[model samples]
Target: MELKILKQDFSIGKLYDVSQADLQNEFCFFAKTDQENSLVCPTEFMPDDMIEREDGWRAFRIQGILDFSLIGILAEISSLLANHKIGIFVISTYNTDYILIKAENFERAVRVLADHGYEIIH
Candidate 1:
């Protein structure tokens, strides 16, 4: 699969509450589990009242729409990155998956992936 890199740096935050705008962004991910409400968005969009946060993530979008029956695409990518000692954060939409990695490791991750024969669309 080809990966499309998103230029924006992102922040993941845990918030007590979120407005509808939080989930209606041009590009974002939000979820509420029993523990806390979580949101991932470009740094500029993060709210002021986050209970916790982690910053410096750059996103990569897996190109093309993914079918439900397709399996192991993420696992294969994750395993490759894992072997290179790079950590990742992942989110899936109904169509495709997004993978996030710390900005510091972005270049190396790209190189490793390129060497492994996965095409990256910048």
Candidate 2:
């Protein structure tokens, strides 16, 4: 398997339990109002209200194309984070996967990923 790491600075933003109505027209990096409401999107299209609640953002890597064969890869990552007591919000697209963690745990998460042999570009 091949993996690519990206280096980028992420802004940490305050997390809020925004109402569904409040997020209807707003774009957000990560939105989770309830157990079923977690949604992660790109930073550029996030709505103003979403940005208004900013506390901190996390830097993540968009690994190679996502496929059924990659489930093990994600599971491995999840296990790693879980063992460290870090929470992760994962978003998957047709092409790749994105992982989100709170800003407070960013460094530790990166180190963990790196220690597991994942190359980090940033």
Candidate 3:
């Protein structure tokens, strides 16, 4: 599989609630449930109401659209990273899945993926 890195630094956060107006950034991922509202976005655009947050993430997305029928793509990648002791945070959109790694592990994760036959586009 081919992957392209996102340029922005990222953050993962939890919020009590979010209004549509609270979303000021185009490059953000928000998900809500009865129990929690979570956000994954560029650090610069983080919401002021975050109840908890973790910064220093870097992300890369699988290239091209993924069909819903596709299986194990995320598992395969995550497993590989797991073997290397790299943890990942994932976000799935209509088009594709993005994988976020801690900034400290980002370069090593990229190298491992590339070594394992995945194309890496910086």
Candidate 4:
């Protein structure tokens, strides 16, 4: 259960699912319509359009060693956010997990995670 947290700033951008045929990398889009809506690796990378909007988004890093051996990591995180009425989009890589919260609930979600004993890097 050892976790290393990193405080990094990331722009909260809008994600839109476009037709696979219409996608272009220059557009900064994330995934195609056929891909799952959940977090995806940058490697299986698809066209993700990063749009600048008036709304804000929250991005955080959960670094350190993770145990894939531990079941329910996603379930635990989802449940934690659910209790606070926050929604999340989770992406994972070989090393760690990245959780994206809507811009509106970003602060509250961070606080809740901190209160629950997860270290807040920032």
Candidate 5:
């Protein structure tokens, strides 16, 4: 699979019930569960008041719109990264998936993926 490194830095935030007003941004990616809303968004637009949040994550987008029938995309990528001991967080859209790794680990993750024959577009 092909992956593109997004230019923007992202965040995976655990917020106390995000207000509906906060969901207006088109770029925001999140899931609401019984516990809390887990969100992935560009760090610039994230509010300071979110009680528990971790910033400085980078996103790598998988290149193509995946058919629902296709499986193991995340599994394949995650397995490769896991063997290298790099942690990841993921978010998905109808088109494709985005994998976020800590900013500190971004460079090494890119290298690891490229070495494994997965194309990394910058």
Candidate 6:
């Protein structure tokens, strides 16, 4: 599988609550469950309602739309990064999965993935 590196830096945060009006762009992920309301969005779009937040993140996505029947794609990539001690946060949409790594580890993570034969596109 191929991976495309995203250009923007990101922020992962926990918000008290959210409404449609809170969302500013398509380049964001928001999940609300019994436990909490979470958001993964570009740094510039980070909202002020955050109860907790972490910045300095960068991201990439598995290239192309992934069929539901396909298995182990995320597991394989996560495992590879785990072995390198690079931590990650993931968000999945209907079409693909986005993996977030800390800014400090982004270059090393890219190099590791490239060395393992996963084509990395800028």
How do the predictions measure up, each by TM-score? 0.95, 0.61, 0.93, 0.59, 0.90, 0.94
Per-residue lDDT over 3-73 for candidate 5, one digit per residue giving the tens place of the 0 to 100 score: 99898888667776667226776578878888878777888877777757899999889999999999998
What would the TM-score be for candidate 1 when compared with the true structure? 0.95
**Clash pairs, model 1 backbone:** none
RMSD per model, one decimal: 1.3, 5.6, 1.5, 6.6, 1.6, 1.4
On TM-score, who's better, 5 or 6? 6
lDDT of 3 by residue, 88-122 (tens): 99999899999999999999999999999999998
lDDT of 6: 0.90
Candidate 4: give the clashing pairs: 28-48, 28-49, 28-50, 29-47, 29-48, 29-49, 30-48, 30-49, 56-103, 57-103
Better of 1 and 3 by TM-score: 1
**Residue 86 miss distance in model 5 (angstroms):** 0.2
Clashes of 6: 0
Using lDDT, give the best candidate's number: 3
| Runs of candidate 5 exceeding 4 Å displacement | 24-26
Root-mean-square deviation of Cα positions for candidate 5 versus the true structure, in angstroms: 1.6
TM-score of 2: 0.61
Candidate number that wins on TM-score, 1 or 5 = 1
Model 3 poorest 10 in a row by lDDT: 16-25
For model 4, residues 63-104, the per-residue Cα lDDT tens digits are: 665677867877877899999889887657566677867667
The candidate, 3 or 5, that scores higher on TM-score is 3
Instruction: Give the alpha-carbon lDDT of every model.
Output: 0.89, 0.59, 0.91, 0.55, 0.85, 0.90
Worst 10 residues of 2 by lDDT: 20-29
